[model samples]
Target: MEEQAKQKLKNYVLWLLSRQEYSRRDLTFKLQKKEASPEYIESLLDWCESLNYIDETRYCEGFIRRHLAKNHGYARIKSEAGAKGIDKTLLAFQIEEMEIDWFQLARTAYIKKFSNITDTPDYKQKAKIVRYLMYRGFNYEQIEFAYTHNQS
Candidate 1:
């Protein structure tokens, strides 16, 4: 009966992985929700890792790429990845490997949102734009560059 349960858990994990990537913690949480035995879940997770069926680094890279496509800055991406149980060192390494220009991405996001406003904005409008950019996860430096250079 225990063997049968383990097989069922393994099948479920395989099916989940086939559909999409999942971090180790994410998979563990899913199995726990199904009330699987903790020992069985741990053993299966180890097996999966040994076979490279679940890789945290690969998951981090995909997560970063998807968020980047949405124009999210480094701070937001890192925070999201961390929440997903990804390692900070691994995520930072992946972001560095991508060689992303955050300032450029900030400018692009600003332009995409404010393309219609051609004239210089008043003080209140400037404050609003800055707040918008900050909420989009850009740091002050990137936001400043985007605000000043995007107009020209």
Candidate 2:
């Protein structure tokens, strides 16, 4: 019975992976929700890893690519990755390795939203832009750089 259940879970996991890459934690939670035994889930995850079917680094790379294409800031990207159950250390390593220019991305995002600014913005306008950038997951330094360079 346990073997049958494990086979079912393995098939389900493969099907899920076919749709998208998932972090180990994401897979664990998903399997748990499906009533899979914790022991089976752990062993299954190990098997998946051994087979190279589940890899954190690969997942992170793909995730970063997709989000960066959407013009998300580093902060927002990191936050979203964390929410998806990626380890902070691994995420930091990937970010550093990728050499992502967060400030540049932030500037691009601001430009897309506001178009080109011909004159220096008023205090109120600057504040609104700052708030929007922050909400978009940029750190203070990245936001400042975007505002300074983009503002006329």
Candidate 3:
């Protein structure tokens, strides 16, 4: 019976993986939702990892690439990766290897969102844009750099 349950869970996981990349935690949560035995879930996760069917590094790289293409900053990327159960050490290494340009990304994001502006915005407008950029995960330095250099 336990073996049957584990096999069912494994099939479910494979189906999910076929749709998109899932972090180990994400898979565990899904199994738990399906009432899979915790012990079996852990063992199954281990088996999946051993098979390289669930590579966190590959997931992280693809995640960062997609988010970066959408112009998300480092902070946002880090936070999202952490929340998705990526190992912090691995995430840090991956981020470093990616060699992202936060400042340039911030500028591009700002420009993409507020491209109609032709002059330096007033204090209120500046504040609004700053808040938007900050919410988009850029640090203060990067946002300021974007604002100062990109504003015509």
Candidate 4:
């Protein structure tokens, strides 16, 4: 490839990364979609990794930060990272280190979707709150905590 073409590919990769953090595999696939060859792709990835331009660990941490702040759970974040080709070990470590307030998060989601859960005594109403929290990727512990506290 010509100098300009290589530079173009490099610039494109930088541009993509500047917008958002991407998994190593995700970024590779994205660059491939732009017609960058395998050899060039690998070389570029090597450069990026060495330069600290794309760190999967940092990406995972950032992803965790964003998702957790958005009130997501371990299972959901883990699955999403796996789908992007992140290693299970790394994902697990991220989850372990995570300081998620499950009850507060669950309560937030429950309230956002269904207000005044404690006021409703009907089984169906309580079930709706449970279902809503579950759908938002909250675990049993968090759901129970939120529901019980809300009832009080």
TM-scores of the candidates are 0.92, 0.88, 0.90, 0.88
Instruction: Tally clashing residue pairs in candidate 2.
Output: 0
Best by lDDT: 1
Clashing pairs in 3: none
**TM-score, cand. 2 vs. native:** 0.88
- Across 83-109, the per-residue lDDT of candidate 4 in tens digits comes to 778888987887778756777878776
Query: Higher TM-score: candidate 1 or 3?
Result: 1
lDDT, each prediction: 0.88, 0.86, 0.86, 0.79
Q: Which stretches in model 2 have alpha-carbon errors above 4 Å?
A: none
Listing every candidate in turn, what is its Cα RMSD in Å to the true structure after a full C-alpha superposition?
A: 1.6, 2.1, 1.8, 1.9
Give the 10-residue window scoring lowest on summed lDDT in candidate 4: 112-121
Tell me the tens digit of each residue's lDDT in model 3 across 1-152.
47787778889999998899888888999999999878888888899899988998998888888889988888888898878778888888988998888999999998898888767777987898899998889999998888777764
Better of 1 and 4 by lDDT: 1
- Give the backbone clash total of model 1: 0
CA error at residue 76 for candidate 2, angstroms: 2.0
| Ranking of all candidate structures by their TM-score, best first | 1, 3, 4, 2
- The positional error of residue 58 in candidate 4, measured at the CA in angstroms, is 0.9
Better of 1 and 2 by lDDT: 1
